[model samples]
Target: MEQKSVWLDEIKFKAKPSLKEDINCDILIIGGGIAGISTALELKDEDGVVLIDKGKIGYGVTSHTTGKLTYLQGSIYDDIEKAHNFKTASRYLESQLYAIKMALDNIKKYGIKCDLEKNNSYLFAAYDVDKLDKMKKFLKKTKIKYEECDLPVNIPNINAIKVNDTFVFHPLKYITSLREIIIKSKVQIYENTRATSISFEKDYYKVTTLEGNIKAKKIIICTHYPFFVIPGLMPLRLSLEKSYALLSPYKNEKFNAINVDDEVYSVRFYKDNIIVGGFSHPLYKNINYKKEEDKLIYFYKKYFNKDIEMAWQTHDLTSHDYLPMIGRLNKNHPNLLIATAFNKWGMTNGILAGKILADLALNKQNKYADLFRLDRPISFTKVTNFITNNFMVGKTYIGTKLIKNKDFYKNVHIEMIDGKCSGIYNDENGEKHIVSNTCPHLKCSLIFNKLDKTWDCPCHGSRFDIDGNLLEGPSVFDIKLK
Candidate 1:
């Protein structure tokens, strides 16, 4: 019998109360997902490390992912070349390949019993069968070892683009092990704690949270999205794309990894069942969170009802150029770094980022640093693609704000202009004040989700507190009282 996720409720974490008193650490790692835990594990041999998660680790996008480990990231190389150059694309693929090997090595090193499987990864094709031709051209130009081969998938009427040496494993299990290692390293791990706000104070950085504050020499944002909004502008710099995954019982299907061209669908056999993942889009266009779940259930009923065991969901943040962003935040904030925007290639890239970041934190030079540079130049196509995709979010946000509600009591404030949501609070002087009503993210239209008591972004699914503080992101920044 396949064991359930380590995060199941029966599990108990007898952790001490987080750092209530102000303390300093050499590094303050935020967001205990794969990137954060992996980073902490890499830096475990180093001294003075602190890692904190708003909730338990591995519960973020990593938990919900299909966990495909391969260098073939959907239609990304085509865009990578346009955004930067062919050399960048070559470096990216090479780095991704390296990351995959690193992941396997780490699993072996820890003896993590996550159902790791080696599968042949395929970038399946649909209307854009020509995409294979494109890949061939890129292969020749970059002098990389790959082929334009038709995949042997059971699914009919679709051509496959095969990328060799891909693997899949249970992400949560891998991350949990990393977390354990980080914790055992004597590195401080805090759960259910948040870094509410951050400010640079001279040589140190002050990280304020609802519970307490921490003074650290360096901060690493593995939060997936940078919570500090305007300065980092992660939401604006990046795009949020979501995909679905279904894990059903396996009943003798022979093949490896499979992803259709145009990324309509992807499938891989995992443990007892085949993990079906893919069918992606910009976050705002298909805002129905349950669509993926529904698809999984529907697939179970129509196709493989017998072997099916469980269903899981995951989200990935894709950059415009379809690559992971790693390295330092900027020259000014040298101590601060980010490893995010994996573009669905987080399995390897996320792990690799941790190693590179650990080296960076310890003042050791990493060879891959230049390729994953934080501030790469964006081409015209990238800018256009970003603007085009975000326009829907902008429009949605603006349209929602124009709605006039008489029942919107004192607690309700709306932005007359972009229609983003704002919080209504009474001041000591009893004055009515209004704030910007939209999410600072891709400017998704905000709806007051009554149950959550927060302004939820309909576009990319970010949630903000009634006071406009960040409850969730793709937005990264909170709704501000402008």
Candidate 2:
């Protein structure tokens, strides 16, 4: 079984060159995931637009997603209504529906073959009938058509609601095809170019990358987690969640389902394989990575009774208000925009973010702009969650610093080497690999991910390979010991 995302298997693309010298552009985008690529596609006709990524396009969080394009997200409208109001929730629902249509229109216009399959989406409840009922009421209030039905999969559920106008597709295939189209336009794309910092100049912002500087009149941060904090205070408003997924060979199913229970189990299909994902927890709360992954595997085996072919995990940033932040960073810098905290529904939110962000950058008035602005009014729930989430982050940071020399796995151990805190892993050939145990972003101690054999930061979601190369980040610098 492979330890990587199934979407990344056998797909190939020629990576664009990294930025080598200082360059200037009218607009500079600092990520290459779904959000970044989508935004680039929107601005392809505009002159002097450049996009750069620390790694290749479509290989980051986008590759690890479940790739469901459905507005029937698991109780999102209910959550939004509870957090804000019905009007807000309804507007958010409208945005999602519009985003789905945008995706379909783009696919049709470009003739992109991404295995787009129209299927029914189900929201089921095994024990949480009250939550399912609440979702049903919300759907009815929003004038959405849904049916009472049983889940097609052989999972224990008491009630289920179904919507038929949803879809599942290959996220990487869609993104790579968009990348090909963007490359043929005027937008410049560079891979392996990490933006380390951004500084405000007299008339523009200067982004400092590893190899060069990017000066642009407008900047959009599409990075999953923004490296900076002061402009938006993103860390306080956002929390990270990690979920596990596994694939097993099965006949293609025409439906996808997610339960509204405390432990979310999302099931979908790709060709002849069944993909099951769930077992989510706050990034700071989950340190036993292997045990968490095992729970999902055990759950799949109990129901599907099939051998797992591949497994992977992903982290998502969730906002306190349960809405994506998709406008200017702050009033002081309208030119500095950002789109993040999708709350695990990146396939829809990311696509809509492109239109909202592009409209903001171009000084055009997008109808949904006010709905997802970064400085929107905060609710009592958002304030409470902000304090709780940050408190957890602080506790985790201090807790990791206090512990040392702990062994998470037999092959991996943390120890002090030459007076420096280092993590050591012994390979199958008995070769020892060592690197700094501290995360470069905030100096938080790293936890060894046993299943993936990588070091992950529990405070934030920064990750590194066994050799200490940066994989995902709010941290751009690698953890390799100098």
Candidate 3:
């Protein structure tokens, strides 16, 4: 079985050159995932616009998505109403619908063949029927057409709500097609170009990258989690969760379903494979990643009784208010825009963020800008959640620092090498790989991910390979021992 995202199979695109010299542009985007690529597509016709990624485009969080395009998210409207108000919930729903339309429009206009298929989206609940009822009421009030039905696939559920006019597509195909268009346009793209720091000049911002520096009149940060905290305090405003996914060969099903239970299970299909995703928890809370993966494997075996073909995992950022932050970082930094915290529904939110961010960058007014502005009014729920999330982060940070050499695997252990704390992993070939055990982002202790053979940060979500090369990050530096 492959330890990678199912969407990454067979799709290939040419790699773009990384920035090799100091460069200047009118706008510089600092990520290449859906949010970044979508933003670049919006500004493709604009002059002097550039996009750069630490890795290849469409290979980050976007590749790991389930790729469902529907406004019938699992109890999102109800959750939003509880957090804010009905108006906010309704507006959020509208934004999602509009984002879906935007995606459809782009697919049609570009003739992008991404295996787009129309399907019914189902939201089921095992014990939280009240939550499902509230969502149904919201859909009714908003004049959306839905029907009470059983899940199309055989899974444990008490009640379900189904909505038509929704769709799913291959996420990587859609993204790579967009990349092709942007490449042929005026927008410049750079892969393997990591942005390390940003300094504010009098009239512009300068972004320091690995091999070069970028000076731009405007900047947009679409990185999953902004590496820095000053302008937005992203670490305090966001909490992250990691989820496991596996695919099995099965008959194609035209419907996708997600349960509203505490341990959510989402199911969809691609061609002849059944994709199951669930087993979500607060990121880095439990370091036993292999056990977590085993739970997913057991679920697939129990339900579908099929052999797993591909298995992988992904991390998602959630906001205190359960809304995406997609506007100016702060009033003082109007030229600096950001889009983050998709709340596990990045396919739609990322597309909408692109529109909102593009509009803001061009000095145009987007209708939904006020709804998701970074500096919007904080509610009682947001304040409480903010405290709760940051408290856990603080606890994890301190707790990881205090613990030393707690072995979770036989092949991996922490030890002092040359008077420095280091992580040692014994490969199957009986070779030892060693690196610093400290996360460069916030100095949190690194936990070995046994399933993937990597070091993962428990406080933030920064990840590194066994050799201590940074894989994903809020950290811009590698953890290799000097």
Worst 10 residues of 3 by lDDT: 227-236
Ranking by TM-score: 2, 3, 1
Give the alpha-carbon lDDT of every model.
0.69, 0.91, 0.89
lDDT of 2 at 70: 90
Clashing pairs in 2: none
Q: Can you write out model 1's per-residue Cα lDDT over 294-317, one digit (the tens) per residue?
A: 665565456555554455444567
Per-candidate alpha-carbon RMSD to the true structure: 6.4, 1.1, 1.2
Residue-by-residue lDDT tens digits, candidate 2, 155-191: 8899998999999999999999999999999999999
Off by over 4 Å in 1: 1-16, 137-153, 161-164, 254-260, 291-314, 402-455, 464-471, 474-482
Which is the better candidate, 1 or 3, if ranked by TM-score?
3
lDDT ranking, high to low? 2, 3, 1
lDDT of 3 by residue, 1-482 (tens): 87888888768776898899999999999998999999999999999999999989988889999999988888778788988999999999999999999999999999999999999899999788888888888889999998888887777888998888899999999999999999999999999999999999999999999989999999999999887766336787889999999988999557888887778889889999889998888885776877888898998888788888899998989998889989999888999999999998999999999999999999998999999998988888988888887888888888777667666578888887888889899999999999999998888988888777889898789999988888898989899999
- For every model shown, what is its TM-score relative to the native structure? 0.82, 0.98, 0.98
Better of 1 and 2 by lDDT: 2
What lDDT does candidate 3 reach at residue 367?
96
After superposition, the stretches of candidate 3 with alpha carbons farther than 4 Å from their true spots are none
The TM-score that candidate 3 achieves is 0.98
